[model samples]
Target: MGPIGGKSKLKEAAVGFALGAVGGCILGATEDPVDKIVSVMTTSGSLKPVMDEVRAVGALGLGTLIGATALTTAMTSVIAGVILAAVVASMFVAMRSCTGSHEHSVGLWASAGFAGAIGTTLSGASFGIVVELIVKNYGMVGLLWALSFFTVLKPPLRFVFKVLWKQGEICCTPGSEVRSREREHIEITDWQQRQRVTLQIEQRILSLEKGGSTSGIEGRTMWATQQKEREELERRKLENEEAEMAQRSIQDWINTVMVKHVDFLAFSGIPMAIVAIVTSGFGLFGYGGHQSVFLVLLALVGLLGYFLLKSSDFKFWMLVGCMGMFAIFVIGMLTLHAGQVVVTTAVKMRAAGRNLSREQISTAMNYQSSLEAVKTAFFGAKLCQLGLGATVGGALVRRSAGDVKVIAGAASVAGSLLAGLEVLAPALGDGGTAGALLGVVGATGVSVGATAATAGRWSSWPGTLGTIGGLLIGALGMGKWHIVNIGLQLPVAYVFAMINPF
Candidate 1:
C-alpha cells in the first residue's frame, strides 16, 4: 500500500508505542547480566582460555558443552559472531515457520522446522569446529565456509520444505493447505514513483486499446518476465513442488541484515565515537560523555536504517531506525561498563600490590565474561526488535477498521516516548520496572481494543496475550534461576512470526 492513502500515520504510531512499551518490559524483566556479557566480548581476541577448558573436559557432550558455552567466550571473533547469529536466525525462522495449516496431518512449513533446526545446529557446530581447527584466526576461511554453507543449503532446504508441505496437505490438518498469498516481499514507493509507474501502465493500456502492436516499454516488461523471473520461478516450482516460493519474509531479512550490520558496526563504532568526542567539545556540553558517543553512533545507525529502508517505506524505516539506535546503544552500554570494570579491577589490583595494568585487567576481565558478551552482542537486539515489530504489526491486521489510520500520528509520538523509555530504562536503576508495567498492560489493552475495533480475521490477539505472559515468566525464570531465555523468547517470537501482519 502507498504510504499516503492508507491508514493515517497516527494509528501506526500508537501501535508502535504500544509494542515498544511491551518491549521495554521484556528488557526490564531480563537479567542485566546480558548487558555485562556484551561488554566482555567487545574485543577481537579468540576464546583461547575457554577453549582450553572445553578441551580439558575431554568431549563436548550436551550438558558439559552447554555449560561450557554458557560459561565461556564461545564466539569472540567477527566471523564467529556472524556464524553464530546466522545459525540462531536460521533456526528461529524454521521454528516459527512450522505448524502451518496444510492438508496433511503435518504441514509442509512445520515439517521443514526440523530440517532447519538440524541445519542450524550443524552450522553452529561446524562454525565452532572450523574456528577451533583454524585456531580462531581472522581470515576469509571462516567467512567462506559460512557463506558456502548458507548458499549451498538453500535449494535443498526449499526442496525439503516443498515435499513436507505437500505431504502435510495430505496428512496433517483438518482442511486443505492454507497458504497466505500475502507472503510476497513488501514493496512501497513514493508518490512520484507511483505516479510515474501508473502513467507508464496507463499509456501502455491506451496503446493496446488502439490496437497498436506491443513494442517499447510494454514489450520490455513482458520480455523481462519471460526472460528471467518466470523461468527462475518455474524452475524453483519444479524443485520445490509448488507453484511459487514466498519471498524471504521481512523478519528473516532483517535478522540476517542485523548480523551483517554487527560486522559494519565493529569497524564503524570507533571512528564514529571519535567524531562524537570531537563534536561534543570533548563532552563539554553536547551529550553526556558516553551518551554523546552513542548519540553520534545513532547518526550512523540512522544511516544504516535509511539504507535498510531502501526506498520510501516510511513506516518500516521509522521502526527500523529506532531499532538501529537501540542496537547501537545496547552495544555501547556494554562497552562503557566494561571500561569501568577494567579501571575498577586495575585500581583494586594496584592497592593489593599486584600492579596490574589497565590493558591486562581489561583483557582478563573480558575473558572472564565472554559468555554474556556473545549473548548480548549476537542475540540481544533480535528478540526486542522482534517483539516490537510484531506488536506494532497489530495495526496492520486492523487496517480495514474505520478511522484507525487517523490515530497513527498520536500513536507515533506515544510509541516514540515508550521506545525511549524502553531503551533508557536501565539508567533509572529500576531495570525499566515502570516501563515494563506500562508495556505489558498497554500492549495487552491495545491488542484487545484493536481486535474489538476491527472486523476481520484478527485472532492474532489471543496469542499475543500469551506472548506477554511468556516474556514475563521467561525473563523471571532466566533472571532468578538461570533458565534459558530461549525457552520463552522462542515461542514468543514464533507467535510474532506466525502473524501475517500484512
Candidate 2:
C-alpha cells in the first residue's frame, strides 16, 4: 500500500488463475490417454466386449466409448475440465472485468459441457451407423470419417466461439477491444477517485453543519483529514494509470489470450466423439478375428495418410519411421514363419470342425504382433498420464494441501467401500453398472491419491491400495472379473503411487 506494486491486484490474480487453468487442462487431457484406449482395444484381439455398452468403459478406451467409460471417465474429464476452466474464467472475469462476455458462474461452463456431451454422444452413435452404410470396411472409411469430423467440426465450433460465445476479448491487443476497454477503465477509475474525494469533502461539510467532531480526538483537525483524503485519491489515481499503461503491452495480451482461448475447449467434444466411434468400430469390426492382407494394407494406408495430413511436427516423421520398421519386421517374420504358425493355428481350428482360409490364418498371426505394439502404446500412455497427473497434482497440493488431503481421503473411502461391496456381493456384476461403479471408485480414488502424494501425504494409500485388492477379490468371488477386461494391472498401476519426499 505504501507504493504501487509492480503488478496490479487484478493482473496477479489473472496470472494465477490462468496457470491453474492450464494445470487443470493438463490433468483432464492426459488422465485417460487416447492411445491407451486404442491399445486396450487392440489388446483384446477381438471386439465382443469393446462394442458392448457394459464392457466398453473397462476398455483402455479412456471413456470415449458409449459405455461406462463415457459415464465415468469422460464425464469426469468434462466436469473436472469445465469446473477447472470455469474457476479460471471466473477469476479472470472477477479481476479483469473488461476481459470477455463469459458469465462469472459455474453453470455457464456446466451448460456448455452438457451441450457438448449431447453433441458428442449423438455424433458417435450416428457416425457409426453412417460409416457402416458407406464404407465397405472400417479401413480408409473410418479414417476419413475421423478427419472429416475434425475439419468440419473444428471450424464451425471455432466460429461459435467467435460469433455467438463472444470469447477472445482476453486476446485483445493493440488493435483490439482490450485496449479500448483499458482506456475506458482508466477514465472510470479517475472519475471514481475524484468522486471519493468530493464525497469526503461533502461529508465533512455536513458534519460541521450538524456540529460533528472538530479536533475532538488525538488533536486531528478537519484540514488534516481533508488533505489525507485528497492524497489517497491521488495515490489511487496514479496506480490506476500505471496499470492501464502496462495493460497496453504485448505481454498482457499474451497472458490474457492464454487464459481466454479456453473458449476453444468447446470443440474438444469432436475428438471425444471420434475416439468413441473409432474405438467402438474397431471392436465391432476387427477384434480377435483375422484380417485379409488387403484389409490390413488399407488400414495401414489410412493410418499413414491420417498422420501425414494431421501433423507436420518432427514427431510425425519419427512415427512414420517407427511404423515402417515395424511393418518391415512383421513382413520378414510372416515370410519365414507364416506356414508353421498357420498350420498349427488351423489344426486347432479344424479340431473344432472349422475350415481355415489363408486370410484368416494370416489375421491370426498378425494379431500376435499387434499385441506387442499395443503394449508399447499402453506403457507410453501410462507414463504420460502419471507424469502429467503428478505435475498438476503437485501444484494443487502446494496450493491447498488441506483440500487435497480431504479429496484424497474422500476418494479412498469411496473406493474402499466400492471394492468391499463388490467383493461381498459378486452377484452385483453388471458390466456397465458395476463396471461404472468400479471405474468411478478407481478413477476418482487414483486422481485424488495422485494429488495428495504430490503434497507428500500418504495416509490415503492404504484405502486406495485396498480398493484394487477388493475389486479383484470381489470379481473373482463371482467369476465376474473376466467379464471386464481392460486388465486390472494397469488400473492398479495407474493409481498405485505413494512416496514421501520430506
Candidate 3:
C-alpha cells in the first residue's frame, strides 16, 4: 500500500510538471508585447504607413499584458485563500466533532473568499500602479532597478503583510449567526429550567426527610437525576469553550501563513516581467552573449536558494528553482527556433533556384519574428475568453446541479471546430488575419459553451452584467480582450500558490 501510494503521488507530480511546462511555453511566447506589437504593425500594409497607430497599439498591448498579469496574480491569491480556508474549515469541523457539537454555524468560505477578494484586489492594484509609475516609465533603467527591488524587498514584504493583514476572519453567515444565537438562548432557558427543577426536587427531598416518610427515597432519586443532567450540561459547555479556543488558534495560524503565501505570489509578476524583458531584448539582438545571461540568472537563483535553504523555506526555494529552470529551458528553445527558422527559409529559397542573399534572408527573418507578438497577444486573449467561459460554466453547474455531460459535449464540439479552423489559418495569407480568426472562433465557442452549460444563468441579470463588464474591461478598456496574461508571470504565480513558496 505504501509503494502504491508513492507511485500515485509520483504520477500526480508528473502531471503537474507537464501542465507547468505547457503553461510556461504559452506565457513565454506572449512576453515583450511592445516589441511584438511593433513587429506585427511593421508587416501591416495600412499600419506600416502610420507610426502613431503602431505606438498606440504597442502601449495598449503592454498595459493589457500588465493588467492581465495582475489578474493572474489575483486568481492565484483566490486559489490560496480557498485552499487555506478549506483546510482550516476541516480542522474546525473535526474539533467540533470532538466536542459533540453538530451545529454548522461557521461560514468560512464566504468570509475567506470575501477577505481574499479584497486583499488580492488591493495587492494587484497597488503592485500594478507601482510598476507603472516607477518601473515602466524609465524603460531599461526601470527594468533593472525593478528586478532588484522585487528580488530583495518582496520576501520581507510578504512576511510583513501576513503579520499585518489577517486573511481569514472566522465569521459566520448572517442567517447562521442568528440561528446559532437563538439556539444558544434556548439552551440557556433549558439550563435555567433544569436548575429550577433541581431546586424543587431538593426542597421536596428536604420536606420528605422532615416528614420521616418512605417518599424521601423517591425525592432523593429525582434529585440525583437532576444533578446528573446539570453535570452533563456543564461538561458540554466546557467542551464548547475548548472547541472555540482551538478554532481561534487555527484561524490565527492560517491567516498568518496562508495570507503571506498569497502576498508572495501577488508580488512575483514584476520580477518575472523584468526577466522576460531582459530575455526578449536578447532575442531581438540574436543573443550574441546568451550564455552569459543564463549563467548570471543561474547564479542569482543559486544565491537566493542558499538564503531560502538557510531559512528552511523549502517551498519558496522550490518555486524559485522551478521558475529559474523553466526560464532557461524556454529561452534555449526560442533561440533554437529562431535559428531553425532562418535556416529553413534559406533552404527553401535555394531549392527554388533563388539566390539567398544575406539582406533578403535577414528581411524574411525579421518579418517572421515581428509577427510573433501579434500572434501571442491574439492567442492570449482567446485563451482568457475560454477560461472565463469555463469559470462561468462551472459555477452554473454547481448552482443547478446540472449534468456534466452537456458541458463536456459543448467543449468537445468547440475543440473540433477549433481544430477545423486551424487548417484554414495558412490559407488566410496573413498572420494577423489568421490570429483574428482564431479569436473569433474562441469567442463563438465561449458563447456556445456558456449558453449550453446553463441557458437560464446565461439569460439572467448577473450573467448579462458580467458579460458586459468582461467585454468592457478586457476589450474596450484594454484595446484588446484578455483576462490573464499568458506570460511567464502566470506560471510563476501558479507555482507560488500551488507550492506555497513562502
Model 3: per-residue Cα lDDT at residue 358 = 80
User: Where is the poorest 10-residue window by lDDT in model 2?
Assistant: 54-63
TM-score of each: 0.34, 0.37, 0.44
lDDT of 3 by residue, 321-379 (tens): 33433333343334335434876979987999977888766555443433433333333
For candidate 1, give the lDDT.
0.37
Regions of model 1 farther than 4 Å from truth: 1-46, 49-110, 127-135, 139-298, 306-311, 314-329, 348-354, 357-359, 365-372, 381-502
Candidate 2 structure quality by residue, lDDT tens digits, 61-142: 2122222112222222322333343334433443453332233233333333233223322332333334323322443234
- Measured on C-alpha atoms, candidate 2 has an lDDT of 0.37
Each candidate: what lDDT? Answer: 0.37, 0.37, 0.40
> What number of clashing residue pairs does each candidate have, in the order they appear?
30, 6, 3
Candidate 3 to native Cα RMSD, angstroms:
13.9
Error of 2 at 15 (Å): 27
* Model 3 misplacement above 4 A: 1-106, 110-153, 166-214, 217-221, 224-232, 242-246, 249-253, 256-263, 266-313, 328-332, 347-502
